[model samples]
Target: MTWYRRYGRWSLLLSWAPFVGDPLTIVAGTLREPLWSFVAIVAVAKVARYLAVAGATLNLI
Candidate 1:
Protein backbone atom coordinates (compact mmCIF):
# COMPACT_ATOMS: atom_id res chain seq x y z
CA MET A 1 0.00 0.00 0.00
CA THR A 2 1.94 2.97 -1.31
CA TRP A 3 1.01 6.62 -1.72
CA TYR A 4 0.81 6.16 -5.48
CA ARG A 5 -1.97 3.62 -5.03
CA ARG A 6 -4.17 6.45 -3.86
CA TYR A 7 -2.56 8.98 -6.20
CA GLY A 8 -1.92 7.15 -9.41
CA ARG A 9 -2.34 10.24 -11.57
CA TRP A 10 0.61 11.81 -9.81
CA SER A 11 2.87 9.67 -11.91
CA LEU A 12 1.88 11.69 -14.95
CA LEU A 13 3.12 14.84 -13.25
CA LEU A 14 6.46 13.24 -12.58
CA SER A 15 6.52 12.50 -16.31
CA TRP A 16 7.09 16.24 -16.81
CA ALA A 17 10.73 15.97 -15.82
CA PRO A 18 12.00 14.83 -19.22
CA PHE A 19 11.50 18.38 -20.52
CA VAL A 20 11.10 20.60 -17.47
CA GLY A 21 14.42 20.38 -15.70
CA ASP A 22 13.95 21.76 -12.19
CA PRO A 23 10.86 22.62 -10.17
CA LEU A 24 12.79 25.48 -8.53
CA THR A 25 13.37 27.00 -11.95
CA ILE A 26 9.67 27.03 -12.70
CA VAL A 27 8.76 28.50 -9.35
CA ALA A 28 11.59 31.05 -9.31
CA GLY A 29 10.99 32.18 -12.88
CA THR A 30 7.27 32.55 -12.36
CA LEU A 31 7.95 34.55 -9.22
CA ARG A 32 10.34 36.93 -11.00
CA GLU A 33 8.38 38.70 -13.80
CA PRO A 34 7.30 38.46 -17.43
CA LEU A 35 4.57 35.95 -16.74
CA TRP A 36 3.91 35.23 -20.38
CA SER A 37 7.46 33.92 -20.80
CA PHE A 38 6.96 31.49 -17.97
CA VAL A 39 3.70 30.30 -19.50
CA ALA A 40 5.37 29.90 -22.89
CA ILE A 41 8.27 27.90 -21.52
CA VAL A 42 5.94 25.68 -19.52
CA ALA A 43 3.75 25.18 -22.58
CA VAL A 44 6.69 24.15 -24.73
CA ALA A 45 8.04 21.88 -22.06
CA LYS A 46 4.63 20.24 -21.63
CA VAL A 47 4.21 19.78 -25.34
CA ALA A 48 7.58 18.11 -25.66
CA ARG A 49 6.87 15.99 -22.63
CA TYR A 50 3.53 14.84 -24.00
CA LEU A 51 4.99 13.98 -27.38
CA ALA A 52 7.67 11.92 -25.72
CA VAL A 53 5.14 10.14 -23.56
CA ALA A 54 2.89 9.52 -26.53
CA GLY A 55 5.80 8.08 -28.46
CA ALA A 56 6.66 5.71 -25.67
CA THR A 57 3.06 4.69 -25.13
CA LEU A 58 2.58 4.07 -28.82
CA ASN A 59 5.68 1.92 -28.95
CA LEU A 60 4.35 -0.09 -26.04
CA ILE A 61 1.04 -0.57 -27.82
Candidate 2:
Protein backbone atom coordinates (compact mmCIF):
# COMPACT_ATOMS: atom_id res chain seq x y z
CA MET A 1 0.00 0.00 0.00
CA THR A 2 2.86 2.34 0.83
CA TRP A 3 4.46 1.56 -2.50
CA TYR A 4 1.21 2.12 -4.35
CA ARG A 5 0.82 5.52 -2.71
CA ARG A 6 4.45 6.31 -3.43
CA TYR A 7 5.18 5.00 -6.95
CA GLY A 8 1.75 4.10 -8.25
CA ARG A 9 1.15 1.13 -10.57
CA TRP A 10 4.75 0.19 -11.30
CA SER A 11 5.36 -0.39 -7.65
CA LEU A 12 2.26 -2.51 -7.55
CA LEU A 13 3.58 -4.64 -10.39
CA LEU A 14 6.92 -5.15 -8.68
CA SER A 15 5.15 -6.11 -5.52
CA TRP A 16 3.19 -8.73 -7.40
CA ALA A 17 6.14 -10.33 -9.22
CA PRO A 18 8.63 -9.97 -6.32
CA PHE A 19 11.72 -12.03 -7.29
CA VAL A 20 11.53 -14.78 -4.68
CA GLY A 21 8.15 -16.38 -5.06
CA ASP A 22 6.00 -18.12 -7.64
CA PRO A 23 3.91 -15.65 -9.63
CA LEU A 24 1.31 -18.31 -10.41
CA THR A 25 0.67 -18.69 -6.71
CA ILE A 26 1.07 -15.12 -5.52
CA VAL A 27 -2.58 -14.30 -6.31
CA ALA A 28 -2.10 -10.69 -5.14
CA GLY A 29 -5.76 -10.66 -4.30
CA THR A 30 -6.82 -9.94 -7.89
CA LEU A 31 -8.28 -13.33 -8.52
CA ARG A 32 -10.81 -13.01 -5.78
CA GLU A 33 -13.93 -11.86 -7.69
CA PRO A 34 -12.71 -10.75 -11.14
CA LEU A 35 -14.65 -7.49 -10.82
CA TRP A 36 -13.07 -5.72 -7.87
CA SER A 37 -9.30 -5.63 -7.59
CA PHE A 38 -6.41 -3.32 -8.28
CA VAL A 39 -4.39 -6.16 -9.72
CA ALA A 40 -6.51 -6.61 -12.83
CA ILE A 41 -6.71 -2.90 -13.42
CA VAL A 42 -3.03 -2.45 -12.95
CA ALA A 43 -2.16 -5.28 -15.30
CA VAL A 44 -4.51 -4.02 -17.97
CA ALA A 45 -3.37 -0.44 -17.57
CA LYS A 46 0.26 -1.39 -17.84
CA VAL A 47 -0.32 -3.41 -20.95
CA ALA A 48 -2.37 -0.67 -22.54
CA ARG A 49 0.22 1.91 -21.62
CA TYR A 50 2.94 -0.16 -23.21
CA LEU A 51 0.91 -0.61 -26.37
CA ALA A 52 0.13 3.07 -26.61
CA VAL A 53 3.74 4.02 -26.01
CA ALA A 54 4.90 1.49 -28.54
CA GLY A 55 2.46 2.71 -31.12
CA ALA A 56 3.53 6.30 -30.63
CA THR A 57 7.17 5.36 -30.96
CA LEU A 58 6.47 3.39 -34.08
CA ASN A 59 4.61 6.28 -35.66
CA LEU A 60 7.53 8.53 -34.89
CA ILE A 61 9.97 6.09 -36.43
Which candidate comes out best when scored by TM-score? 1
- What shift in Å separates residue 20 of candidate 1 from its native position after superposition? 7.5
Per-residue lDDT of 27 in model 2? 45
Q: What local distance difference test score does each model get?
A: 0.54, 0.48
lDDT of 2 by residue, 1-61 (tens): 4433455433444433336223432444433423345556567656766776788989952
lDDT for predicted candidate 1 compared with the true structure: 0.54
Residue-level lDDT for 27 in candidate 1: 46
Residue-level lDDT tens digits of model 1 in 1-48: 254346433333443574544653454444462556555655676787
With candidate 1 superimposed using the best TM-score fit, by how many Å does residue 53's alpha carbon deviate from the native? 0.3
* Every model's TM-score: 0.51, 0.37
Leading candidate by lDDT: 1
